[model samples]
Target: MTQIQNPIIPGMAPDPSIIRVGADYYIATSTFHWTPAVQIFHSTDLANWQLVGYALNHGEVDLRGTNTPAGIWAPHLSYDSRTQKYWLAYSHMQNMAGREFNSDSFAVSADSITGPWSKPIYLTSIGFDPALFHDADGKHYAAILEWETRTGYQAPGHIVIAEVDLKNGGIIGDWHRVTTGFTTRGCAEAPQLYKHNGYYYLLIAAGGTGYAHGVEIGRSQTIFGPYEPNPTGEPIITSSPQHLFSLGDPDAGHFEMFNPQSLMQKAGHGSLVHTQTDEWYVAHLMSRPLAGQKKNPLGRETSLQKMHWTADGWLEMADGSNLAKMHVDGLKDVPVHQATTQFDINDDFNNDTYDPRFMTPYRTQDAAWVNTIENPGHLRIHGHNSFFSQVNPAIMATRATSLDYTVQTKLTFHPDHYSETAGVGLYYDSNNWLYARLCQADTEDHTVLRVLQAKLGERIDHLTDEVTVPNDTAEIRLAYHQGTAQVLYRLTDTATWQALGTTLDVAYLSDEGVNGAPGEIGGFTALFNFIGSVDAHQLTSFADFDYYTVKNNLERGTHL
Candidate 1:
């Protein structure tokens, strides 16, 4: 059987939506507050996956002044056999400050999963976690959670099922409140509906997206019944299975013994798919919390558990337990691709389109900023806005692929005036990042490299704090040994590499580590390495990004 090392899809790939097209499988994940949203991965076997494209093009949506983790939420992808078109349903969680989580579900159609996708059409205001289920006959239904607040409630609101019109906006029929207070942990969400063996099954994510998280299943003879709970009368999949409807509530389960050491905690929020081989697997979001922490890594990534239908017709996990892990021996064998822990940061910029892994902040990146035609060998970015804004800017970055890696890039700057800046750095979030950039000194057109600190809330930049070093062309490298980060720069062809004085404590920059006052510690997403030119005086500057490569396990450290 194919053995997937834990975290088959790692680094901030959360709320995964999976669809198998022929022998190929594609998964799309959420990219909240990170522009160029909805990362898609392709896999011949579930274990080996590579980033392919993004469902949303940059500037497809406007997210100015968006809060951390508030731009885009769960996106559901489904395939229509009748039209042979890939249909996507997703929710943009526009406002979180008011705790609204007011979802505007939208739909987009693409002939191919690697889409030249059509523009999105507003589906409905159906709360969040919008899923599209197309019947064998081409009839489509949208199953979504109607999150509402009530006084003195059993945690939040109910899970409602409605038949939605794909061509039109919402369902033509009335919504049925399937379950009011499921109480499986605390909150119930991420509902996916499937029909198997003369029955309609509804899978839900319950327990507040926390350490108490779990997956609960129910079935009915009709499409939407007063759905009957599982025969066990509890969630079909849950860590600390003995407990139901509550966590740390011993009163919920009386039969099972207590356990104190569980490796996979808060494992739930899932979707089930049958492979081409007719084997069933459930893809759920799980978190790898920081050591000894019950708190999540600012992300809930996708994990899978195998399932089998019993003689009694109840869908149960193969191992009698729900927690997914490193390997499953029963399934068919899957091949492991090259065992590479390093990546190159070089760009040819020859393709008509930039790689999907390269993304800007909120709003569309100007096509003019990156020129394959105008500048054949280099990238010219006419920086219209600064990096501080969530809108238009020439900022592009990739996920921190690993914790231990060396990232270096050669940059040649053609600076015209002061106030413009360009450079690369280790970016966790907008507020919490550190790196060095080449800026044109206000007094002279000569470009001087300056190291900048992006700490949250302290608006006053300590530019004068670091001695400005002169460099018209320099090769900059960020070497991260475990938690310590050192910035080094060398003049072109120079054997001597000058260490930009001072080291940064990077352990605090991770989502599982330290969160800036305004920044939240996110999941195990990558610290991006990027190169850009910020224009100071409408001077069109070109940055010849020679190459960028990331290698993991370059060295281990003691700090973190």
Candidate 2:
């Protein structure tokens, strides 16, 4: 029998909303502030998954000036077999300041999964993480977390359900308040409704998306429920199965629940699907922190666990344990054609178009700034704003999938001014990043390679090992191990790669290390390797990237 690895979809693909249409399985995840929002992955066998396309490729919504962890939230994917149309519901988190948590939810539909989706219909602004449930009798309902800001109420809020009309955005009746949580782990959100055995089951993510995160379930006879908790009154799946003292705490970092023996952490926010063979599985979000460190640089990834319905009509893990596992048994003898055990990326810039895996922050990328046709065998990016700018920056990046990995790129750039620089490095967001770029030296006339660091929005320059490049081309590489990074560069293909600066401790570029406002959680976005250009003087300066590659030392596993 084939064994499936955990994290079916890795690197910042959190809050998985999975469903099956016919014989194919599809999962949609949150993109946060990245453009082409709502990443969708398809799989035949549960072990292997591939990125098919993004649902919001066109300018469906503007993400300009979106803060860290504040754009696209959980996206629910559902197919109405009767109508033969696919529906998607997602939340656009616009603000987090003052704990306002103001968010707008919308719904869009298309005839096909990979599609020209219709314009978004406004759903509600009451909360985030909206999910659409299609009933067997042609009734549609929306379930979401109604964010509560009152002093005495629960910190996050309650899961509410209401009937909604899909054709026109209209709520049928008042929002029905369901149970806050099915267990003591009380930061309940991401409510997904499923009907099985004549019961409407409500699956929710609890434990605040931190060290104690887990998936809890409740069921009721009616759609709007005074739901009953699971018989065990505990999460069905979690990384830390032991009891946690901080049950109702709203803190995002629960250091007490950090299990030293476990490789996976923060396993919660699950969605379930029934296979054609009558086998059941749940896809949930999980995180793998760096070895011995609690900081998660890869953010939350999607993982799968085999589950079964109890004789008493309750959902339980097939293994009879609450703890999530690193390896799971495949569903029967499902044959998969293209399946790999590891994750790596290599792009040669040989095609006229860019890969869908490469993404930009905030605004949609314009062809004038980032294009491949300008340079036949290269990716030409015209520098516009600096990396700190939220408006427009010539940056093309892909998610960093592992802690021990090397990201290398060959760049050809001519920087007439000191502010005009272009190269490759790792980026967390606008306020946190590390870049080794080809820029002009203050004392010299030619271009030189320099290393710059941004920690908590403060810029630091490592000016010790600056190397001057006589030509326009250079190869730069960034190797990250554990929580540290080393930047290296060479002028020519045959030249030895020289270290640009001392090893820098980049553990702070994580979800917990990056400081957030008083009422907001720190960045939950994943680390990215990008080749970007900065032109403070003018937008005419451009950089051509010959190739980019990412190589991970470890196999795709549950730990760093």
Candidate 3:
């Protein structure tokens, strides 16, 4: 039988919401702090997925000044058979300070999957991870987590359900408070509603979003009524399925529940789908940490697991175990074919358009700063602000998909001032990045290449390896092996590559290492390889890029 690999969509693709429209299957994942929010992937075989397009690419919302792990969260995708429309529901996490967790939910629709989606219809701000469910009787409903802010109540909140009007964005009735959770593992959120065989199944993510994360299920006869927990009294699927002593603890990372035996951790927030061949699968978020370390630089990725319903109507893994596997049997009797499991971005900047995978942070990309038409053969990036600035910065990046990889770029930059710089390197967020760029020296006589590092708002410069370039053009490469990053550069096409800096420890540029205060989760965005320019003085400097390439060396199931 064919085997489907884990992480069908890798690198920071979390909170998967899967739905089947005719023969094609689509999954939408959360894109926090990244502009063109809510990435949607399409797959027909379930083993392979491809990036189709985005739902919010036309600047329906503002993400400027968004904090780490705060922006568009938990995008839910559904198809309305009655209207023949595709619906997307998501939450805009506006604040996380003091655990106030103020968020607003919105919905959009399109006639086709890759489409001219409608403008966002205002939804409720009651909670995050809101999902829209369309019943067979042509009624619409929204299921969400009513965030509990009071000091003494059940910690994170309750899973509430209410009838809604999709056209006008109004709730028809009062929000019904359902169970906080159906299991011992609390912190319930990401509620999805489905009906199977006259039972309304409510799927939830619990046990936080860390080592103890798992997918729990409950059921009720009516759409809004008392629900019953799973008979096993534990998560239907998890990385660590064994009973935990610290149940109901409101901590994000329950490190004590880290399963020493499992390679995949933090497996939860699942979305289910039934294939055209009558096979079932659950796509959820899972993490693969570096060997012997809990730091997840790749962040929460999307993985798939085969599932089957018992005669008694309880969902369970097909392998009969709750532990997520690295490989599993694919859809039965489906024709197996070679699929593109990984992406190696090699852009020549010759096309008139940019790749869909290229993303900018916080704000809509400015045509004045980045343009491909003016230069024709090169990507012209005019610098705006430094990388730390939340506003406008001329950084164009693609997701870092592997722990062991090489990212190289050919750039021609003319820096007349010391504040102007442009090059390619790795980035986690505005607060953490490492870049090797061409800039003017303090003497203001010649141009030089330098390597700079930022960790949690602290900047460090490697002054010893700075090299004087004869001209304005250079090739820069960032080679990463496990947690160490090395910067190399060559002045001319014929010159051999020379080291620009010492081997820098970059493990601290991960989700766990650069986290926020206590009780708050760290940034879950994936590492990115970016080609950016910075002109803090006049913002007139521009960098012309000939090409950018990323090669992944780590094989599946080996390094991961």
Candidate 4:
């Protein structure tokens, strides 16, 4: 027997949709505001996974000026055996003003999972989290959450299903309104339909997306019908299995539902896949808060839970407990790839191309702003807007996968004006970040390094202490541990690293600390360690980065 650790895909990999084609398995996760969206991971033994590629890499969708936690949501990945094609269904959340939750759903297909993806075909504007299901009779059905804005209705709305046409992006006829949720835990969304043993099972995420999050199921004999809820009247899987009656509740962050016994919180939004040996598993999203706090800095991650179908056709955890575990049993016959290596960021800028794992927010990465071929041995990033702008910002970032990690970068930037700055730090979004950059002082011939922070839309500058750089170039490093960060810099590689600023508490950069809509949850994204440039003076200023490296301090056996 092999034991698989939780969080198969960690650090900002949420809303996982898993499918197994023959012996190979693939999982697609939501990217939110980060581009090169729709991350797809490949796995062979269910214990080890690798990020293969993304489905929406060529500007298939526009995410300009997108708000926090409101870009691409819950991307569902499925395959049709008849056409031998892969399908992806996702929602582009355009606006959430006045609780309208205006969004448009779209679908894209490819012959292979990696490349030549087709243009997005518009599916519906009725709701979000759209998923496509191919029936045995060759009929295609679409399921989505019809958002409700009225005062007295079932808060977030019901899961609606209808026949859809893939070639022409339109629904067949009317959409049947199914149950709002299987249990009293309301705020139902992310509907994934499956057929097993002559029954159509509809799995949905409920209890908002917070501490009370859970995976609920219901079944019906027909495609559209009054489905019967699971007889247990509880979620099939959740972090907190204690029963709670929260029907029609619009709040997403049920902080009171946090369970003390489990390190993994906010476990829900699952997608199921059957292994080749007839075993079952569910890939779900979960979060791990700080030691004794309710803030989640790493954001929602992907975890696997072993499942079994009962004689009554109801799905449940293999251990006969609804509470999620930190370790689960692996596949029966397949040997576990137990000792996997973690990916560390070590870009030397000597190659002609940048790392494929690097992603930018609020804009796409193109040769217009980011160029590697222009500078042979250096990554010349032309600064665009300021870090506060929800527009185009020159930032090359990677997910912060470890709780304690160090990020180092060498910058050769000569800023003539104070508005042109270049440096590296941790970033959450446009409104919340901590930056340490090199900028020009009041005089023209002097350069200085300062630390700046943005928390809940308020700017705080550490003007008390500033380090002067002699030649306008230096090596910058940020060390983060638990929930605090320290900025350090040195002019040369041989010199010792000197602290530039006092230790700052950056726990506010977590998902529960950032600002969002007036009545909704705070943020859905995690903290990212980034090397960026800000040239508000003129877009012509560019920063030459020699190398970028991220060193995780966790032991190999624990984190991997």
Candidate 5:
């Protein structure tokens, strides 16, 4: 048997919705508070997945002023044979303050997976994690969590199913609750409806989204009815399989449920797919925390688990264990194919277009701000708002796919004022990030490079004595290993890299470290290595980046 490693699509890819069409397999994961929302990856072989593009690349949604964990949630991808269109359903979690859990769901369809998708049609404001199910009878349905805010009820509420009119985006009838006591684990959400062997199955993510997260399933004869939980009464796939009922707890940081034996923790929110060959697999989200800590700097990632249908028609892991594994069985006759968009990225900026992996936060990337054709061989990013703005910030970033990684970029910028700066560093959101920038010093006609840090909205200037930059050009590099980051710089092109500041503790960049609101759980998005610019002075300043390179050193043992 061939062994395939877990986390096939690593780093910041979470809440996967997988589907198989012909010989191709695709997985769509959530991208909260990030532009080009709703990440979609393709894989010929299940073991190796490559990001094709995003569904919301067009201006279908505006994430301006969106909170850290309150943008795009679980994006459900499905293809309708009747209409010959691909449908994507997702929730826009607007507010989480005071436990309101306010959300609005929408759906957009396209003829192709990566294409000019249609305008988004508003679905409902019931709750989040909306999934679309097209039945054999050519009718469509949507299942979602009906968020309960009552004083004494199940914390997150019930999984309800509704018949939806896809054309007009309206519900055919009232929502019907289909689950009751499905599993011992509580905080159930992310409902996916499927038809299998004369039964309608509902797969859910139980035990919240933390260490006790797991995949649980139920079945019923009708589309909307009382579904029976799996006979085992346990999650079919999870990192911690021990019994735990956290009904009233909506927090995503159940740190006490951490499983020490498992290398992949918080493995849940799974999407099942039957391959072209006679094989079964589940694409789910898993997290690899820091070695000695419970913080997942890489955030939730996409993993694959080989599954088999029991004789009684229940889904279970092929190994007959509830524990999730770091390595599992692969396809029998399929050869592993290398991913085109691997973890290590080196963009020379020679191409006329920017790398598809590049993404921005809180705002869309347009030719007005970021473009490559203007400079031919360099990516020119015009400054917008400062890093503290939730509206618009000119920053090009990609997901930090490994705990041990180094980011290098050569910046050619001349800041007219201290308020206008440009450089590269790590970012979690607008309120939390680390920036190494080149700006005009207090002295006349002098440029300096300095390091700035933001932790939970508090700013700290780490570099008191800044290094002066000659001709306002320098190469900035950041080496991050196991939650600590070191900023290095070289004045000349061929000069050796020298450390600029002491090692900064950045483990707080993880999901559990940055809190969004007063009562909201920690952030959902992970850390991103970004090349950003800030213009508090004026928006006329632009930064030119010659090249951007990121090398993940996890396999090489954390050597910078």
Candidate 6:
């Protein structure tokens, strides 16, 4: 079993939808505010997964001013064997100003999971986490909860199912209301359907998506039920294992009873997948609080737990407990694969094109702004004023996926003009970043290395020491040590570094800080290691970056 750290997928990888196509398993996750959203993953053993592509890549949605936690919500991935088509279903959570739960659900189809998918066609303006269940009778059914405030009856939020026309993408029959779910598992939602042992099993995420989250099971002999709750009358799996139902918190399906001893908190909203070896697994979302409290830095993450079927015909955790962890062997001894996250940082810079792993800031990339032919084998980044106020400027950034990692790169320069600064740094939002660059003063054309820091909506203030770049070939290393970070610049040709200072409180500059804004957190956002050249005042001199690399000497506890 591969000893996966609790979250198989981290950093806001919430509402994961997994599907099995023969021996192949794939996962599609939600991305809120980021462009080219809906990341899809593929795996052969179910334990080792790799990102294959994204469902939305053509700027189909607008995400400006999206509040924290409100861009794209739950997304569902499913495949049809008859038509050999892969489908992506998701909700665009447009407005959250009133917490009104306004969402638009849609679907897109592709011959392969990673491909030229058909354009998204609107399905319904309903609640989130919409799933399409293919019935054995050669038909498809759509399941979702209709958030009702004016039903005027006892049940406001109800789970409804209807026959769906997959070809035209529309509801084809009268909607049927299944049970609102057992009283103990209140606020029942994120319904996923499966068929086994002559029963249509409806699995749902119950309780709120908060402290009292759980997975509940209900089965029916028919696609549309008369569904019966698991005989246990308790959640099949949950973090804070509870049977408590108040029926008072209007959001919790109006139930008041709950269990007390749950280990994994907020363990709900999951999808099921059966491995090639006939083992069953559940991929769900969970969060880790800050030390003792519930201030989460990395938002809802994806976790996997083993599950099995009971003799009584209901599905449950393999060990009969609701905790997220399982004792079964997952992929404990899988060999380490080559680095899939990035490229070799050491570069001669004479290459005609940039590496694919490198990306630009908020704007689309322009190829004409850079040229290596001017000076053979040297990167000539013509500074277009400071890092700001330019769309197609020279800035190269890479994703920071691990908690602790070291980044190193070499810089060689012959700047005869003033105000040219080039170096590496960590960036979160547009308003927050820190860098260590070598600059030349306009008056004497004197070159010096300087460190700078920027806070929320503030200028990049020069923080510390200024010294000469010992030699022309300066090697720089930045170590992001957990919550803190440090920068060390050395001249490889001279073999000595004039040390600046380390910023220990990196959390303050993260999405958990004052600037990391909404509909934007971990999913659609990331901290990047960047290599840039800026002309403090005007574009005069050029800063040449020889190569860049983030090290394997991670400072985290696990030494990743």
Backbone collisions counted per model: 12, 0, 0, 0, 0, 30
- Which stretches of model 5 miss by more than 4 angstroms? 337-341, 516-521, 557-560
Write model 2 residue lDDT over 230-294, tens digit each, in one string.
99978999998886544445546666788788888888999999999899999999888887788
lDDT tens readout by residue for model 4, 159-269:
999999999998999999998999999989999999999999999999987899999999999989789999999999999999999999865788889999888899999
Q: How does each model score on TM-score? A: 0.85, 0.97, 0.98, 0.97, 0.97, 0.75
Measured with C-alpha atoms, the lDDT of residue 67 in candidate 5 is 75
Q: What shift in Å separates residue 349 of candidate 1 from its native position after superposition?
A: 4.0
Each model's C-alpha lDDT?
A: 0.66, 0.86, 0.86, 0.89, 0.87, 0.65
lDDT of 4 at 263: 88
Query: Which model, 3 or 4, shows the larger lDDT?
Result: 4
What does the lDDT come to for candidate 1? 0.66
Candidate 6 Cα misplacement greater than 4 A, ranges: 1-6, 62-68, 145-158, 173-188, 207-211, 231-235, 242-266, 288-296, 326-328, 331-399, 408-476, 491-499, 508-548, 552-556
Ten residues in sequence with the least summed lDDT for candidate 6: 253-262
- lDDT winner between 1 and 3, please give it: 3
The digit string of per-residue lDDT tens for model 6 on 363-420 reads: 3334444556666666566665454432333567755555567777777765555656
* CA lDDT for candidate 3: 0.86
Name the regions of candidate 2 deviating beyond 4 angstroms.
245-248, 336-342, 516-521, 555-560
Top-lDDT candidate index: 4
| Residue pairs clashing, model 5 | none
Tens-digit lDDT track for model 3 on 1-560?
89887777878789999999887989999989998889999887887788899999988988989886789999999999999999999999999899899999999999999989999998899989999999999999999999988887877888999999998996888999988887888889999999999999999999998888999999999989799998988888899988864444555787777888988889999998888888788999988887788878888998988999989998889987888887878877776553543567788888988777888888777788898887888888998788887778788988877778889988888899999999997888888999899989879988889987888998888777788877889999999877789999887889898887579989877777685556444778878889999998887789999888888875644334
